[model samples]
Target: MGPAPTVHAESVDFVMLYIVAISVVLLIGITVTMIYFVFKYNRKKGHEPVDIHGNVLLEVVWIVIPTLLVLSMFYFGYTSFRELRDKPDNPFIVKVTARMWQFTFEYANGKKTDTLYVPLNAPVDLEMKSVDVNHCLYIPAFRIKEDIIYGQTNHLYFNAKQTGDYDIACAEYCGLNHSAMYTKVKVLLDNDFTKWYGGNWQPVKNGSASN
Candidate 1:
């Protein structure tokens, strides 16, 4: 887990851990039970075998327990997925367009930039699309990825509590230069974001920051 963001880190990671833990427990339990049954029910040299068809309680317990476990896992998985789609209050919407090896982020004021810049502690809603082939918007640090499909608009939701520059890359194989499609998302303090959001600000050069 590298530089985990708030919302996705909590919800997504919890669901993953929950499912994994349950799987590990089930694996051990089932293996042990199988071994024990194999030893106990082994055939004796010359004894007649008893015909034990089935036990209703044992069968019901097995079916009910697995069904309940599966349902619970599905419940948590659905809730975690819903958390990503839940729009926050007082959101800052950015329109993102992806093409063959490039990403463009447009703010509400028509200010466009290659790098995504947002205020710390503020919610950001991304409206994404692709101009050419399909692309994927991926932020590894935050563990967020969304598909950018041509002729169809996609969306990604973000809320960063900390301030820093996070790496952004195209995860989908779009074209020959797909490996070179990369950018950064800068989360600035509230005061700086306000000043830059309202002013006629210019984008800084690569390897440089306005802060």
Candidate 2:
């Protein structure tokens, strides 16, 4: 079908759009203000540089406006980040281990694969650890990325809404073949995943065919 959907899709979109909107507004405002000041106080126009003390009202306006804007941005970003950090209850948990240049996923049923297989629309918790150096599991489609440490357990969650194969890669630079330290996350339909989980395992071809 189409691309696999992640639970963080909307949140990511919101955060990105919010940041972009603010950036665009600020960019335009600052650019226009600079241009206006350039022409309004041009040296060629015989205007001398005025070294007057700054007006308290202008200073307060600038400070308060930017402070409010920054606070609002922080609020939105923190809210979105909090949603990503809050783990779901009783999710389909998978333990992920990163070693050298390979990735492994182990399920509760003892089923393991180099590729992560998750059920569509179901919350999946990835409990991750690194065997050697530090690594980060980055799934761009799910907007889920977390650092994996040798002595610590790092986790992230996602819920795929569609069946498809998404790319997974290590965001951290481990060593040689760090670029090759990549894999796929195959999102399957609920029924298909159930069958596979129950040991009636079959390959999913073209993301639609289970054979």
TM-score of each: 0.78, 0.88
Candidate 1 similarity to native, TM-score: 0.78
**Residue pairs that clash (backbone atoms under 3 angstroms), model 2:** none
Clashes of each: 0, 0
Error of 1 at 108 (Å): 2.5
- Predictions: Cα RMSD each: 6.3, 5.5
Per-residue lDDT tens digits for candidate 1, residues 32-70, read 999987777777544567889999999999999999999
lDDT of every model, 2 decimals: 0.84, 0.83
> Which residue segments of model 2 deviate by more than 4 Å?
1-4, 199-211
- Model 1: lDDT equals 0.84
Give residue 7's error in model 1 in angstroms: 2.4
Candidate 2, residue 115: the lDDT equals: 96
Over 65-149, each residue of candidate 2 has an lDDT whose tens digit, in order, gives 9899889889988887887766554667899999989999998879889999988776778999888999999988877799998
